[model samples]
Target: MSREEAVQRVAALIKGIKFCMLVTQTDQGRLHSRPVTTQEQDFDGDLWFIGGKDTEWVHDISQRPEINLAYAQPDGQNYVSITGRARLVEDRAKLEEVWSDFYKAYFPEGIDDPNVQLIHVDTHGAELWESSGKLASAFALAKGLVTGERGDMGSNETVSLE
Candidate 1:
């Protein structure tokens, strides 16, 4: 697919997913991953997420900006893996731009909280896999059982945002 189409497809696949795995590298070089809500917005190669200044991942991003974001739609068997560089965004206007009530549960003090911070992930590239459905999987299984051949799974592609 073309670059723009690829990004659009990734956005569509992740639209219904409320959360995704945000992976960062610690000072010890170990990968740390945690669930973070997916901000409601169009995926135009840049992703925004909320966090706290004192949070470990924020610190981790400060030291190492390279990161990965993984999103999955289990029922549809659609998944996306995105590699990018992350940085702390302290812009008040931008923070307010993406603020939501769900965040209050995490930051009791609300957006004004001294610790509140925004993470900006600049996309590098992404890989996506999407299956047709259970029927297709069953068909694949039956095909394998009878013909010993794997049936068509679905579509998979690697996209570059750069």
Candidate 2:
């Protein structure tokens, strides 16, 4: 798919998913993942997240900027995996723009909290899988078993955002 189309598709798939697993590489070269709140905003090859400057993930990102984000909506059978580079940002304006009241739970001092920080992810590529629905998927599997042929389970595509 075209780059623009690919980005849009990923955006649509991940829309309204309040949380995603942010995966980063630790100092030991092992992978670490944590659930983080995804800022409510339009996706445009860039993602914003709220985090703590003193967090382990933040330290990992400082050493290795490469990261991955996994978004899934099991009920809708849509999943997206995005590869990107991340960095800690101190953009006060952006922090305010994406700020939500729910974040007060983490940053009791509001956006002014000294530990509050922003993570900016510049995505380069994504892979997405979309299925029709639970019923359709079940039918496809049954058909495959009966006919001894591969059934059309869904559409899976990998696209470049860069």
Candidate 3:
């Protein structure tokens, strides 16, 4: 596919996946990853996430914004990786736009809570693979039978690195 097509496909995949691993850098320069719920992206490719202001990751991103995000299906046969830089946005209006019931479980007080913070991950680009995107399960199964690999699996990723 053309580069533009690939980029659009990647974004579509992102819209389909709700959870991702947000990777961030520690002070010692080591990488750390945590599961986070992804909300939406702005026109400039800025991804939105909600977290606590005093969280380790919030602090990490403050010092190191370079990051990556990953997503995949349950079967582990499909996955995507997104590279981005993150910055904190204090816009309550933006959070209001994306907040959902899932987030209510974490923040009963909602987006206006003093502890809540917004993370805007600036997506530079992404790469993806879906084992069943083409309905090629039978073919993949045959290949796996020969190669001794597993069946359809899914993964989605969003991360940060030093």
Candidate topping TM-score: 2
Ranking by lDDT: 2, 1, 3
lDDT of 1 by residue, 1-162 (tens): 677887887788888798999999999999999999888888888999999889999999999999999998888889999999998887899889899989998899999988898999999999999887878977887988899887888878888877
Question: TM-score-based ranking, best first?
Answer: 2, 1, 3
- When summed lDDT is taken over every stretch of 10 residues in candidate 3, the lowest stretch is 153-162
Model 2 lDDT per residue over 1-162, tens place: 788898889989999999999999999999999998898998999999988888999999999999999999999989999999998998999999999889899888998999998999999999999997889988999999999988888999899999
Per-candidate clashes, comma-separated: 0, 0, 28
In candidate 1, the residue pairs with backbone N, CA or C atoms under 3 Å apart (3 or more residues apart, or in different chains) clash, namely: none
Clashes of 1: 0
Clash total of candidate 2: 0
Report the candidate with higher lDDT, 1 versus 2: 2
Best of the two (1, 2) by TM-score: 2
Q: Estimate each model's TM-score.
A: 0.95, 0.96, 0.75
Q: Encode model 3's per-residue lDDT on 1-162: one tens digit a residue.
A: 454555566666666566889888999999999999877552235678888888999999999999878777655356778888899888878878877767767777876678888888767777666565445677767778998987663333333221
* Candidate with best lDDT: 2
